[model samples]
Target chain A: MTAITVDRLHKTYLVPEREGGLRAAVGALVRRRRREVHAVTDVGFTIEPGEVVGFLGPNGAGKTTTLKMLSGLLHPTSGTATVLGHVPWERDRRYLGQMALIMGQRNQLQWDIPVLDSYKLNQAVFRIPDADFKARVEELSELLALEELLRKPVRNLSLGERMKCEIAGSLLHAPQVLFLDEPTIGLDVAMQRRIRSFVAEYNRRTGACVMLTSHYMADVEALCRRVIVIHHGRLLFDGALEELVHRFAGDKTINVELADEHPLDPAALGPLVDGHAVERSATGFSVRVPKAETPRVAARLLAGLPVSDLVIEEPPIESVIEQVFEATSAEVDGG
Target chain B: MADVATRPVSGRPDFSKVSFGALRRYYVGEFGASTANNLAYRGAVAIWVVTTVIQPMVSIVVWRTVAGPAGEVNGFTSAEFVTYFAITMLVDHLTFIWLMWEFEWRIRTGAMSPLLLRPIHPIHKDVCDNLSYKVIGLVGVLPAMVLLVIGFGGDVSGIGVVQVLTFLPALVLAMAVRFLLEWVLALSAFWLTKVSALNNLYFSLFLFLSGSFAPLAVLPEAVRTLAHASPFPWIVSFPVEVALGRRTGAEVWVGYLAQLGWILVALVLLRVVWRRAVRVYSAVGS
Candidate 1:
């Protein structure tokens, strides 16, 4: 069964606007002006149960907006969505009990109390049976290294520790679907990896559907096999992560390392790489080539030089996503 | 889950039924958590109770001074003034809500978003929190009430069995009416956007008309009539008078009916306004 289905989802904010001037401020008192912001427009996608999907976008590209709608914290200006066979915006208690939405930047735990007490509140509200609550808390504690931190008040824990506890507290009910919006945001690399792996483990154990958004490409790379890309409130791409890289990553880099005996010659090597400028280092030179021509270009470089080491690499996912965003931005501007 | 981690839960509690037992369990659990939270911040709770206690003490001193050594101003002797202000302190502490002051921040910061996602209504948690704070804060407030009464020579001789019996229900009803009224007023922040000035105005009117500043009998006839016309006196002053045996017989029944009427109005207003507020936040993301 499909876990989440979003069709023609749209959210437009009627935001009041005024120029930053005394006269405009005075005039606004009598009559205000408003502008429409299309936060999410006709966004459509479906994820099967147990599917882990990356939701990628630049700032204000509607990633968070879409997640809020699916979690039933929001109702779309227009369109329909369902999670686990119930319309999300209907906010039936059953649907709410079965789903969890965690935002890394915002906290829901009571600040003055121990983290475990907050989890108890969730248990009471979600109506988790005592045995299940205990087992689930134990499993999450073991997975997230939360035993030491759960007794501390949330205000006393570091950001990373609080986040670990936050994720664990959110899962006490064993929600079937988890919407993680930058769950590792602002954490150091080690903490980020821990959270990423915990999410993966939780999904693996429970067969829960997971949709995640993050600025850190490492998070997306490790957790999401399928990715959906959105830009300017529209779906730019939705498919396997590799498919995304293959479709949007326009070029590959080829590096050739030579023995010290082979003197550096930027002039003579210019013609070998289709006359494209060759980037040089003390022991090697690398050339950018279209992904389709990497083999041929590598062969020419190998045949031309006494190469000690040779390497070919695709651009990193971060750069590829930036390229996708830049290209979409250009398209919007041009149109 | 059984495939890997642990056995399937044997008993799935159907909380969806909204039965009385389920509600009791939910509230009991929430109350425990809230009480724990209140205990964790004992200093803050003590400060809150101190503030509640101090206000009535000031009223007592000022009103007693006006009443002179053994004089009676508008039928209120110095001792009777002490009694009225002392009772007002306890009732005010029981009914006050911070929602009117902090709700705007909650909305602007998106702090209330998590509350919307929960399976249970947000008001249930708020009620639990409010009750828990009062329960914990009473540790300080109850003693302060006794001290103020004793220290100020409050006239407790007039308080009879009927008055004590009736005051319990009156105080409970007063708490309900005042909390519901303020909760609905706090929701005005959703549309008002900036509510501090409005909140100040609300508190100012509440102080004057609720008889916290002085006994309604000591105030001018017009002010007393206005206070009765509004919902303010029924919340604090009427209950205080009922406890002091100042309001007797038919007047006591009238006060109860008036409090019940305000509760019904407040409940209806709460339902309508809360429905629209959620719609606004949902339609246009806060």
Candidate 2:
């Protein structure tokens, strides 16, 4: 079943533009210049229950704006989104009860109090039956290893520890959907890995639908098999990560190890393969070819060189991401 | 997963346990923690309390001087005037609510978003914080209040045990009425980014109309009528009147009835305002 459906979502903001210097500042009091920014434009997607989808975008590319609309923190200027068969922006108590939004940069925990007290306070707000509240808190504490941190003031906890508590607090009600906005931001590698695995475990146990937005590819690669790339307020691609690479990217690199030094010039090779080739050593060079032409290029390269070892590998995902943005910008400039 | 830290305890309890037991555990420990917090900030709290209390004290001195050599002015003897303002000081301190300022800060700092997401209305936490401060500050303020009354040479001979006992409920209701009313006003923070000027204007009007300056009866009939129509007089002056035995029979009944009316009005206003305010906040990003 579909847990979420967002159709043609659009959000526009009227932001005031301020001019520098005393004269403009004084004039702004009487008249202000306003510009409209379309943060999300004609975006649409759906998530099935238990599906983990990564939302990839650059800063100011409307990732957070989209998440805010999905979580009902914002009202869209146009179009609609429904989570668990209810319109999110209506923010019905039932919907809020069944969903949770966690932002990495913002904290929901009370600064001066123990984490347990804040959790208890949430129990009252959610009106969770005491028995259920206690059982959930104990379970979360064990899952997140929060036994030691529960009694200490949140201010005393390190960033990583605090993030764990924050995550645990949000799940006290066992929400069916999670909207995570850069959840691993600002944490060290070890902490990030721990949180990532914990989330994967939680999703496996609960089968909760998750929409994750993050700049870290590690987080996306670890948690999401499918990713939707957005830029300039538009959805660029949506499918499995491998499909994304296949659709927008060229193919593999043929890395060759030669037995002895040989004078080889990449330009001397025919057609130049329309890609990059580099020497790893005096006799070693890597030649890249489109996936469709890999066999033909390998035949020529192998016949032409005294190669001892050869390995072909898919290009790195980071390069593909950079190339995707470059292609998008080229399209815009060409238009 | 079977080797969980503890057995899944049946967290449910009977109805009695939910209401009394939960509040008891929260308040008892919360009270201790709040006392320690207050002690840590005693220097700042003392300064704030002194500044706030001195406003009433200054009003007493000014009214006493206005009465001059004559024993009575505007139906109140100089000594009675002293008693009135002294009682006003204590009542005002106890009844004053800062939810307006708190809500303004909470909304502006985006703190209200987290509070809203919580299952409880943020007011419950504020209630605990307020009650805890009163308990902690009572140690210092109670003695000082008695000293001021004695030093001013006021006539409190009519304040019997019954009036003293009646004062407690009157004060608690006054606090409730003030909290709800101010909380409704604080919702204005959602719509208006700058509400401090509005707050100052509201308190300034309350000062003149509520007999914080002098007995409402002493004010012109026009202002007194307005005060009676509003909740200001019931919140401050009614409690003082009951404590000083100024109201009897029908008057006491009417005073209690008026407080109930104000409570209803406040409750309705809060519901209406809170819904609209949350709608507005949710419409805009926090």
Model 2: which docking level applies? acceptable
Best by lDDT: 1
lDDT, candidate 1, A110-146, per-residue tens:
8878888888878778787676778788878888889
Indicate the residue-level lDDT of A286 in model 2. 80
For all candidates, state DockQ relative to the true structure. 0.50, 0.24
Which residue pairs clash in candidate 1? none
Output the lDDT of residue A304, model 1: 90
lDDT value, residue A256 of candidate 2: 83
I-RMSD for candidate 2:
5.8
Task: Tell me the tens digit of each residue's lDDT in model 2 across B1-286.
Answer: 6332222223423322236555555555455555555666788778867766677678778878888646677678777877888888787877777878887887777677666654335666777778877766666566667766888777797699989888777888888888888888988998886699999999999998778888987888899988888889988999898888887668877878888889999999988887778666632342
Q: Under the 3 Å rule for N, CA and C atoms, how many clashes does model 1 have?
A: 0
Candidate 1 residue lDDT tens string, B97-123? 898877788787788789888988888
Worst 10 residues of 1 chain B by lDDT: B1-10
Error of 2 at B165 (Å): 4.5
List lDDT for all candidates, in order.
Answer: 0.87, 0.78
